[model samples]
Target: MPILQPIGRTLLIFFAAAGRLSMFAANGLSHCVRPPLYFRLIARQMIDIGYYSLPVVGLTAIFTGMVLALQSYTGFARFAAESAIPNVVVISITRELGPVLAGLMVAGRVGAAMAAEIGTMRVTEQIDALDTLATNPFKYLVAPRLIAGITTLPILVFIADIIGVFGGYVVSIYKLGFNPTTYLKNTVDFVQTEDVVSGLVKAAVFGFLITLMGCYHGYNSKGGAQGVGAATTNAVVSASILILCCNYFITEMFFAR
Candidate 1:
């Protein structure tokens, strides 16, 4: 009975947290649909989430592609399957690496920021002030972020796909001594629209999860500085975990023969 009690308590807490998150998500999404939409706030979030994030995401994608090409070549060389490197690189970048890596990078950078900012507002009573001032915090705060996240991550991942593929191209041709023309041909011929589309879909889902986690943690945060800090950490960690978990489910949905 004692052991069962602990297990039951854990399950209860889990369900409670899930329920709260669902409620928060519902409210945020509802606000997103019905609104005197804040285009200016959404635009600012877009710049913060997408444009400012480009350099880090681009660098990560390029280096990832280069490393993947090199590693694939090494593995395939044993079987003299080097010709498959280009196909492997392109398919990998478009189907998995680009979206997943970009999602993680953005989660770390943007999720933490969102949590910290909102948590600060929460702890400082600014959110309460919004209520007093007749401003709907959900619409003003959460919806714009949600909109920007959903809209921008796909664009970021698309650019990452290009940069990643280019990285592999550079490595294959310059470092591996492969014929540039043949590598490009294989890459072009092997990759399909579905691959890129699937990645973009994953990006959108990831974006939503990231913003959702950040907003949920921050909005619910209590205490003062310590609580805000904890929220920031939880936001990043939760978003990253959700990104990986969703990546698997999304991939299975898209490619599960």
Candidate 2:
């Protein structure tokens, strides 16, 4: 009977999870369709998640671009192709590394924070309290975060692209002795609008994934501290995994054979 109970409980939890996710998706769609939008909350979240996160994202992008340039210069120099460094750096940053790294960083910072806050609210029944006060938790709690993520991530990614390109520029010019003008010219000529657009699109998708996973896990947390901790961990893990998987699909959409 004890063993049977465990299995039954597991099945019940799985079904609950599926139902919760479906409901969340439906509610999100409904809120988006309805009027009386919550712009203030969304703005606040944008400041918190997007603006505050800029320093870390910018720093990461700069260092990544610098390292990529350095490494590529070494390898390409071996083939007597050092002139390709600018093009390589630009393409790599704009297409792949910028969006992916920014998404990963936000997953660690914003995703975990969202999950913990919402999970704690759940455990304390504050979400229920909102309902009791005739407030919609979906509108009040979830909408802001989702909208902020969607709006602000692209901006952040844009900044990251600039910083990353400059990082590569510094590495190429100073360390590798490439002419700055030539390097900049090669980068400008090699990159396309499509490359930048593709990365921004990926950033938006990643933002949505990060917020969705955080809200889903946190809103459904159970028990007490242990459950909240689990939700936070799950939020980060799921957001990171989804970001990577979605990157492939988005890349295919942009550049598939």
Candidate 3:
């Protein structure tokens, strides 16, 4: 009975945490659709999440495509199948690497920032002050971030896809000595609409999850500065984990038999 008690307690804790997170997400999402939406706040968040995030996402995407092309060439050359590099690069970039890498990068940067900002508010009584002033904190803070995250991430992912494919094209033509025209043709012919659409869908889900984790952790934070720091760390880790997990399920849903 004593040993069973510990196991039971752990299970209870896990379920409780999950329940709290779900409720927080539901509450925040509900506010997103309700009246008194803040367009200015949404625009600010969009700039923060999208515009500011471009550099990291772009660098990560371009380098990923370049490395992918180089590695594919190295492997395919062994079988005299170097011609397939363009197809591989395009399909891989549009279908997987672009969305996943961009999501992870944004989760690290934007997610941590959200957590820190909101968590600081939580610790400093600013949220309570908002309540006194007749402002709904969730509606003002969480919804804008959520709306911006969902809307902006897809655009970033699409741009990343283009940049990634172009990186591959550069490597294939300039470094591998492949014919530029032939590489471009293969890339264009091999990629389908389904691949790009699936990637965009994943981006939306990843964005929502990233913001949810950040806001949830921040809103629930306690203690003080230490707690805000912990929330920031948890936000990044949780958002990253959710991105990878959701990516697999999304891919399975789109491509599985």
Candidate 4:
């Protein structure tokens, strides 16, 4: 009975959260269409979320590619498929790993930050103050972050894909003793436009999911500092989970023919 109670409670919370999230999204869409158009806020979010996030995303991408190449090389060598290294590396990075890693990193970094910031605002009565001052909190706070996320994630993923491939290139050539010229040639020839497009699409969806989760949790935060902390944690966890789930569906849609 105790175990069943816990499981039931967990399911209840999940459904409640999902319902709130649906309403939150609908509110956001309505505000987005009827906005006073906060372009300045959107631009600021772009710089903060996109520009400031570049270094971490790039570093993660490079290291991921390098490590993947090393491991894939070791595995492929056993099957005597060494020449396929470039193809595998490029496809793996561009199709799934690059966008997924970028999204996870951004969720950990940007999502938590957004949730904390907004949660703080909520607890401090600052959001209430905004309401008193004739400002729509959704427009002022949510819209810019949502738009910035939609715009920037694809760019980050694109950069990640390139850097990850380059990392693989370096590892294959310098560390693993593969011919640089042939590696580059195979990578270029094997990587298709669809691979890149699929990654970009996934990135955009991930970006939106991350930002939405952050905004939703933070905007609805309760308690005080402890509540804010919980919201931040929830935002990161939810965003990361959603990114992984969405990535699979997107991949299936793109390539599961």
For model 2, what is the alpha-carbon lDDT of residue 242? Answer: 91
The whole-model lDDT of each prediction reads: 0.96, 0.92, 0.94, 0.93
Winner by lDDT: 1
Which pairs clash in the backbone of model 4? none
lDDT of 3 at 53: 97
Writing each residue's lDDT as its tens digit, candidate 2 over 116-149 gives: 9999999999999999999889888887788888
- Error (Å) of candidate 4 at residue 209 is 0.7
Which residue pairs in candidate 2 collide? none
User: What RMSD, rounded to one decimal, does every model reach?
Assistant: 0.6, 3.0, 0.8, 1.9
TM-score of each: 0.99, 0.93, 0.98, 0.94
lDDT of 4 at 241: 94
* Cα lDDT of model 1 by residue, 1-257, tens digit: 79899999999999999999999999999999995999999999999999999999999999999999999999999999999999999899999999999999999999999999999999999999999999999999999999999999999999999999999999999999999899999999999999999999999999999998888999989999999999999999999999999999999999999
What stretches of model 3 exceed 4 Å from their correct place? none
Ranking by TM-score: 1, 3, 4, 2
Across residues 138-187, which tens digit of lDDT does each residue of candidate 4 receive? 98999889888988999989989999999999999999999989999999
On TM-score, who's better, 1 or 4? 1
Which regions of candidate 2 are displaced past 4 Å? 1-19
List the candidate 1 regions with Cα displacement exceeding 4 Å: none
